[model samples]
Target: MSKQRSDEPEIEPFTGPAGGWGSVRSLAEVLPRERVAPDALRQLARQNKPDGFMCVSCAWPKPADHHPAEFCEEGAKATAWELTTLRTTPEFFREHTLTELRGWKDYDLEQHGRLTHPLRYDAESDRYVACSWEEAFDAIGASLRPLDPKSVVFYSSGRASLEASYLYALMARMYGNQNLPDSSNMCHESTSVGLKAAIGVPVGTTQLRDFEECDCILFFGQNVGSNAPRMLHDLRSARKRGVEILTFNPLKERGLERFTDPQNPIEMATGGETQISTQYHQVKAGGDIAAMMGIAKFLIEWDDAALSVGDPPVLDHAFIAQHTKDFESFADAVREANWADIERESGLARTALEETARVYARSEAVLGIYGMGLTQHVKGVENVRMLVNLLLMRGNIGKPGAGPTPVRGHSNVQGQRTVGITEKTELAPVEKLKELYGFDPPTEKGLDTIEACRGVIDGSVRAFVGLGGNFLRAAPDTDAMEAAWPRLDLSVQIATKLNRNHLFPGKVTYLLPCLGRIEEDVQASGPQAVSVEDSTSCIHGSRGKAKPASPHLLSEPRIVAEIAKRIAPANPRVDWDGWIADYAGIRDAIEATYPEMFRDFNARLFTPGGFWKGNKAAERIWQTPSGRAEFLAPGELNATGFADADGRFRLMTLRSNDQFNTTIYGYHDRFRGVKGTRDVLFINQADMAKAGVEEGQIVALESDAGDGTTRRREGLIVTPYDIPRGCLGAYYPEANVLLPVEHHAEQSHVPAAKSVPVRIRP
Candidate 1:
């Protein structure tokens, strides 16, 4: 391996708990630097409160017993980032041409702060000029009016509130299309597909309270410290309660290993942090399915041995026989699984697999938690199915402190889907919507994110309307997506801040500035409070307290309503003006759409901690075609096995601790000890030696997408890390270019971001 370079930033390892003084210091440093106003601090403090706005970060559930400071460091950064004094007014846009803005980095683009007014592209001048909301909406309606409704794509970000998402989805349906593609199609789509097949419900069965009672928690493919720091608190508490925490990841994340609670002053002052993972298994990229299958095989063998000897059975036979089907086939598949194949595929020893199974089998309450790592692969759906199989072996569902939970990325991603933002228009919600709204919604399936991009490229999709997100930057194949975006006849972005997507102007492009989550949303009637469902299915109200950055800014609900009125002026099925005036009316329509789950929506929202939209799986009520939980047999352990070629490595894209989704807070990854740069590729020392690369050596990555087209990203510094052999990790959005647009999960169509095959060049 190459020796460390003296000129590079320090790469020392961190061994503290995820939170503590480090988080406090980072928050303090960011607030002042961002020029956060004094009133903004009050706004930040109200985050996650009964009378306040929900954090716009990750979807970790808020605690029922609210803490004075319920937000995490990343949440604080997001709040400060949004509430910054910096503003991108018309003058700012006038100063920066579209060409100049396109050349800026993602962080620099957002750091200029919130957009203050509506802008329309001036092609002659190559700049975005301020335009009135009415003119912008009129342009959108004009472009959309000519195209077939099937050619229009309505995309949403996970940051959208439930009320706004419902109205947006309704607008699309009323216009005679169901091309509702949200961020979930890029992140948790695999989870929804897998879980729905396994347990007849697309949502997680576990609640936040389950963490308190869980005997064992198995985390796969997730780094709670960086992505969802608030989860560290729950994990730490569970650890103290004698709960065994086992983590499976390609790299040994510092937050998962140990974490200091920044909320605990004593821990911060004494430098005392709590140990998190009871055991950390370094599974290779895309090896989670194999690892889970291996664990299942071990559990089956142990159960057989116990039953043959007349000892108490290891499996929950009663629960299995009563609540599930296809078990015998699933069990046989696990039994027939070859140990040698599991070892080679999972990169773990037989002994380690057996030990993990033993721990799982002995535990009465087990909780399985996963993130994008498990869901961003070619076999992502099967990977999650394997996890559910393991959980089913122990009757983990419908029990306190036990179930499978896929920690979502965005705050209201799940909520958006819950409130009818989906491509599948034949779902129950569509039928209910037809009955309630007096409009016959589309029954045909529509384009997801990947399909939408493909449609744009093939000239099938002509108009694109984005409701809050940097779609171009967040998608795979950045160069291809950028090229395809300009092919659209019309493109509109309803956002609070400037992003790379805005720089790529279509034939007719408009930027409609909307109020951020922290800004007060005043409608015709009065101020409104929107609701968002957390990871655990708890629906809570989010009422913004901070003043709007600009008087021109409108609430997301109002923007969607206004667009709907312009696009479908002749439609008399719904009253857009009435709903926009009172958010309660919007909730009433949502209740009519999903009556069972959203009953008493207004009253429950005003409750102390809002309400839980109970999960059918949690209640042991299966809603599948089989009328029971199904144990589907998984395919081969390593379905997407890399070719037996030399110099090949599986690359998984990851987020830096300084970033949230595509928005960058800074260049430093404090948790990983990488300072001042995001261009580093994390690789194991053995892999570095095998590739003939030394530590801190610059390298190029060429995609092995098997499509006969070469895609390469250069200038990535290879840094020796604790990753498994033959595996590498790089920051996302930067490394996204290496992923081909066609590379994605088969069933869900979500991008296979975790298991990209690449060759490193020195």
Candidate 2:
């Protein structure tokens, strides 16, 4: 059925529990909102040796002395959801046919319970019958025996262990395919692409320690509390010490305005929320690049003019001369930029924009932090370049408490890219993988998410395997993922729980149940531990406390190793079982593979917080092709707000308060007053007025235009918001219905979620 108008899917709102970041029963609804007794949840937590699992939710840096309760609310939710006593055994599948399961919601799919055994969907039987691990692997291996390597696409999630990722990459390379469409392509592809072109590396330039000493912190589109609450403490401490903190975002998230640190006993007792945002600017959705370029624009011209007037100003002329190239063109772009246009288009007044520039100019050190909002646009790469340009103008990189901070969302997402997850560039380490394995890796550039989707539909891709993540739900345009999967010869999902992605089976579907990060991994050796790198490049150890939820549940590493062993090309010397038996062997292999990047891997992992990778920006050393960071000239600006047309307001899909990626928490977003359904769209009052739509009016939104097909979901209740004028916002996956697969960024293939051109149908 080409899904037509929806009279607003009912949204169920949920308020988080009183227990601060760790209290997650309320958020555990990401799986099933059905409330288990407090006693049952308490029991679940008691055994959850959560030490081994990286917080599945956010990338909070690991502590020197790990707390038994180091888990955050989202972490707890994911942990409980994974380690839940529930199970989706063979009988459960037998009772509820695939057809019955297909009718379920995303929450119900995961809530169907964890898979206890390796399952092969039996279409004739209309059930997922349990199969022997050997039988499952053999069947999978035989399926890949004849296809050209390019037909196999190895997709992975950020939550994957370093060992699993390395092995997965090795398998793909050995198989001679580079069709690696990872989570990075979907999220931080812009950051990686932009940062590499502008600076040297694709990772964040600053460390967490820099926050304490930063003179001024500028947050662009990042809501710290909801996304990264640990940053809340840092900003709070900085504010107390008289550091100026400026925030610019489309949504004036209440969490950004004031955050109560439930982590602090005294603050929790007093019920006091820290007041952040010394200055808040509600900039337009696509304004970040303009805003940043405006800042750089103002500082460059102001300082240049000031120097001519015999007055010293803020631009670091000496640093620019020594560490950068192409000054004249950059200066021209900044000087020639029209402030009226920037102010008008960005939805910020000139004075406010100029004042923000002044803050950057005046500060001895500044950190320009951004989230998905900046990098998920058509000009996302340029947007990042402008931020780096501002930093370079003042020599922010390589200085303490300064540089660009791309506030990533997940715990291991950064680690995924660092370990060479991209389909672009043949990274040195990945190259070494080819050299070590004695194979000629595919020289042709690999397909990213969008390319992979298109590849599958066109029959170029024969097999698709996801290490983790909801590929169907996580991807844009539900129809694209659904249509593509059925075309594949085989589709494998190595996941902890059942999701909709698994239901959309290929010709020969295999669902391999894996252990959650929070569960104990008892192999031939003993309990195992994994490591993850946060956005700041700090590597830390994660150990699981909870015992296996099901006796048959396989650890991620074990499952990956088994699959690699079976499905990998013949004549492989590496003993997959040797590594699976003990993660230390995997660590040793990683050390052998990436000695420069991962020195003393095994020894240092025993250290309290693992180790920190040296960030060049911290030392002001740009590793760009020029040996110094190159400041990119600003790109041309795109039109904004649809010429004040009476069309549909622009819709930006957002994650629900309780959701992570495609996993909907309780169908509600509290900060924005959305509850009981995700069918609500946040509309600017002015945009609503122009569109002739009221606050509660329901309307149709078509997510795509270019493609022959369109995703139309109607009956969306419009909620007026304090967002940028002419902008609309709604929850994703549910709203993924409205995001066209083709509406992606230029350099990154990332969906231009923040700025898709759409007209509201009255």
For TM-score, the strongest prediction is 1
lDDT of 1 by residue, 1-762 (tens): 233444756676765557877788889889987898999789878988888889998888887688789999999999999999999999997798999888898899999888999999999989999999999988988888878999999999999999999999988988988899999999999999999999988989988889888999999999888899988889999999899988899888888988888778788779987899988899878888778888888888888999999999989999999999999999999899998988888899988888888899889999999998888888889988889998998899998989998999999999999988999865537667767767788888988989997887788889899999888888888887788888889999999899999999889999999998888888888889899999999999889879889999988998999889888646566889899899999999888778889999998885656688889999899888888899988877873445435878899999988999999999778888888778888998888777888777778899988888778887777788888888888999889989887889889889999989899965
Q: In model 1, which runs have C-alpha deviations exceeding 4 angstroms?
A: 1-10, 639-644
TM-score of 2: 0.93
Kindly list the per-residue Cα lDDT of model 2 for residues 498-591, writing each as its tens digit.
Answer: 8888888889999998887767788898888888887888777777766676788888777767777766766566778788888988888787
Query: Which candidate gets the maximum lDDT versus the true structure?
Result: 1
For each candidate, what is the lDDT?
A: 0.88, 0.73
Given candidate 2, what's the lDDT at residue 357?
84
Per-model TM-score on C-alpha atoms? 0.98, 0.93
